[model samples]
Target: MLTRKQHELVCFINDRLAQTGVSPSFEEMKEALDLKSKSGVHRLISALEERQFIRRLPNRARALEVLRMPERPEKKAPSKVVSPQLRQLPAPANDVIEIPLHGRIAAGVPIEAFEGVSTLAVPAALLGQGDHYALEVAGDSMVEAGILDGDYALVKRQEVARDGEIVVALIDDAEATLKYFRREGAMVRLDPANRAYDPQRYLPAQVRIQGKLSGILRRYH
Candidate 1:
């Protein structure tokens, strides 16, 4: 079985490749993983290459390739653990926008938006520095969050989120949920705009903040 850190590294490398059509440099990996030395990242990459999970070309830049998928472990019977929420489906190309669907939303009870069903074209300037994704809101759960349904949200790809800020969160790796972010110690909460759906509370470990909601673009049909 792969170590937790190895698993996280694999996921991060794959996600970056899928988003940017290229693997990150050793320095990028070092910064992303907070490693003190490039050798640390190199070791991890070497391990992944040896396991056939990734391929690396010698002396070439951005030449890593995903070879085989990691094996999923067998679930124990009567497992209470829930799956992690996936942020968005892999885009066909790095240049295309992949918006989260959240799920089937309604005019009444606010449901979280699904991930990666809708998309829009946006100039890189609108995304600011180091930003790469834009998600389309599918429900009004965030109307109170200052976001409306059918709005295109310009997002800055990030791992950490600040309090009282809007964010796209994965609720169990199955749904891409939207809410105002709040955190206290080891706990994180998703504050909804509508009253029908209660705010979601999660351990910091269970929730993954995909990105911060930078700006919104809306259109009426």
Candidate 2:
């Protein structure tokens, strides 16, 4: 059973979708339900989703579909029939946005490049704009930056990055390492976050910027 707010939210979303092809925004839902803040709406939506009454469409923030209606035990009147146009089936519940998972990349010394056919499903809200890929961090060289071992680094596909920006640096097109990209006169420098690790320097032609670090994701037990 859904809470009162959850029921109201689902009904509101369903009605909005039926009226228009789009779902209502959080602000609209909050206003409709007399919510104090958007966070409260988020919580109610989460509860409805967990109960399998609704699901979010892939790579969309406001794309919500009502899976099933809540039981209305208090209603004694006949149920209202929904028109065929407004009652279209929703996308599959397992729908998700997946980006390339390029296996593990080094956070310390450079490691040989690897290719894989793996992929990872990520929340669309975590990413924006251009293409992105995921890499499993293999070392603790960026500990001070809160990037730890076993963390998944979300990188935006880019051939260049500004100074002080953390990036995936490909060394001589043979190996890659995650570090801060810097230009020192005619040369390139890969700076590690930990003081224990020395900065790596190489000729500009020898180092290639593969991608820029967009965000980091970690799992806790």
Candidate 3:
């Protein structure tokens, strides 16, 4: 998947090529993307090339060919953020609720997150008003965020996610992963908490926001 900058650059290049039958110059691309220097544009070009989204014509200074166009996601207005202070807290609960456990989910890379179905009993306080589920974290990519392997991730069901929110993202309706949801420009970026893992990018349509992280459960023993 391409980041927002990458997506914008690719689209810009595609439009320019289609209009003039020639690739845009570095200066034009830089201006189009609002980058201070052409270096940023170069990096975006390299990234696009690596992802096979765009390619440079051999021996051509500014010739870039679009390999494929990214699919646009459905249009929807982002939900308004409710201030934490404004939200009324639920009354204290002494009971526990059983939530569906969808097996293991990768924190380091995309994996088949929904597999065997089971149930996990969680404190009612751990979840709020929405439909909730649980997934066992299976990797260390989110260690920096205090999510470690073997921890239980409490998720609230939702189709849309705001930028910078941690969400369970299903990729291509096959694989799912736990990462921070962010909008780079025109693409979606999934950021891992650990410095060792690189952020993942994809077309907006390729990512389905399955849920938002509600709470984390850990066993000391």
Candidate 4:
């Protein structure tokens, strides 16, 4: 059985990995747990490693790996049962939803959509009902909108994107651009936020809507 401290550590690691796609370093772990010394944190980690609940990589920073979580045994009731004032609450809703991370898509042309490139487990509370995918951003066209090259964007797949909304658009059935999507009768326009690049316009028939922008995700080193 894990002690209170060990349980806390496990929960912390799980939350961090879900959000940032990486685990924290020993020093980070120490700080997060508010331990007085790094040695104290190391002791707990060592115990966990020995139990085969987690794995440690030598000579690598932030190298802790989770092998498997220890299971909790069922609690036995006492002969004299007394219900406490505090009742157990239901589990949070987000725990049940699965978010898929679709690989990179070209903003220029009609490309085949690939599923299950990777996945992020998100709380259902944070996402709406729709097909979720990820796009690896490229270029500085939308830099003004705070999206940078190499950033990963979480997109909600949709057949129709709204005007003035940032969208991943395929123009002329060939090239793709991330821009503000707008339509005027028979024409569609892909307007970049940066002035250095000119806006692209296409006949409604020539453009294809691949996906709509839902959210942006960036990782820091």
Candidate 5:
């Protein structure tokens, strides 16, 4: 069986090659997987090669070849009747904005450099004019704010956010999390909507504002 890190690296390389027709560089892989150094990436590559999951070209740089791609789960057929709630979502008439759906954000640990696994389209009016991206919610911390697990949080890319607004906050440059932003004195507090979870506090310099939450989309099956 492949280790968790091995699986992540393989998927990252496969996804990058699929998107760009070129394999990702060691630096790109390192940044995507949040590894400390290129040596860590080399170790994962060696492990993947031993498993016959990937093959490294002997003479070329960044010429690693993917031998076996992982199988994706088959998508379910579309339903005949679309729900009214979904119909109400703003979609541009002539120009539908495509939002890249980055992978899930850790509500607890804070994931950084979200890999663009898919895309979601929303109306131009709803997201306004900005670089927008989507992330899958993973925890119940924001339940009171109506953001539940499995919901997509639409984020407008911005480096700063106002107090009391929902924003994607990167904590300590290691983990990215969704929370309410509030600056208290010299520290920043990330508050959860649910009462069960306590607000996380940190130094002002430790937190980096990624984007403000613009809207949310949910599906009922």
Candidate 6:
């Protein structure tokens, strides 16, 4: 059996090859896997080749091909037990929901914002029903939250959010940013997950809650 990292590396390379008809560059693989250097990528590639999952073309650059893909495991029956909290939540419908993928949102300093670059189709079960949208994260301020540069944040559109919930906070009606939201009387505090960033506080009137975070998606390639 492939190790977890090896499995991920093979899947990523396979995805890129299938989508773009070419292997991803060393730099691309390095970034996708969060590897420190291209050497790490090389090792993974060697392992994949030894396992007969992939092959490299001779005398060619970016010439990798997938020989076989791992078979997906069979789906098991649903469990009978459901938590009380989960039972209160509605089950998602059996249909794909298309959500608008808004342009990048700043995770560090607030930035000028735009919306509706494209739409992404996701299963409704993944995100609870609401006016949901997505934003491509652009900064590393939320790295400690497992959110990284280039990650996509799935958000549920709402004007209000509970304290400690990660939110898209628009400051002074001019800039949009993402952070954990906290309320202190009439003031609002936006806290970044990274210790490197100090929390930002502002008046409630100056900040608008655009959305509350629902989930995150990271594409390796």
Misplaced by over 4 Å in model 1 are 1-119, 123-125
Per-residue CA lDDT of model 1 for 1-221, tens digit only, reads: 23334556787788898999888888888888888999777767765664467888779877888776554434231121111211221222235344433333322233454533555565332444565566656666655334567666666778888786667776666456767788866888877655545777888777787787665555656
Task: Choose the strongest candidate by lDDT.
Answer: 3
Give lDDT: candidate 2, residue 170. Answer: 89
The candidate 1 region of ten consecutive residues with least summed lDDT is 77-86
State model 3's lDDT: 0.79
Compared with the true structure, the alpha-carbon lDDT of candidate 2 equals 0.75
Off by over 4 Å in 5: 1-95
Clash count, predicted structure 5: 3
Report backbone clashes per prediction.
Answer: 18, 0, 2, 9, 3, 0
Against the correct fold, how does model 4 do in TM-score?
0.49
Query: Model 4 over residues 1-221: C-alpha lDDT tens digits?
Result: 34435655766776787788688877888988898888767767765664456887789778777776644322432212111101221233535455666656533333444433777654443345688766666677665455667766656777688786777776566555666788877789887655567777788887777677765555666
Model 2: worst 10 consecutive residues (lDDT sum): 77-86
Of 2 and 6, the candidate ahead on TM-score is 6
**Candidate 3 Cα outliers beyond 4 Å, as residue runs:** 1-92
- Write model 2 residue lDDT over 2-95, tens digit each, in one string: 4345666888899999999899999999999998999878767765675578999999878999999965423221122111111222222333
Query: Candidate 2 clashing pairs?
Result: none
TM-score of predicted structure 1 = 0.46
Tens-digit lDDT string for candidate 6 (1-221): 24335666778888897898888999999999899999878877875675578899999998998888765322331222111111222344477788898899999989876554798776666577678998888998876555788877888899999876789988888789999888887889998756668889998889999998876766766
Weakest ten-residue segment in model 5 by summed lDDT:
77-86
How many clashes in candidate 1? Answer: 18
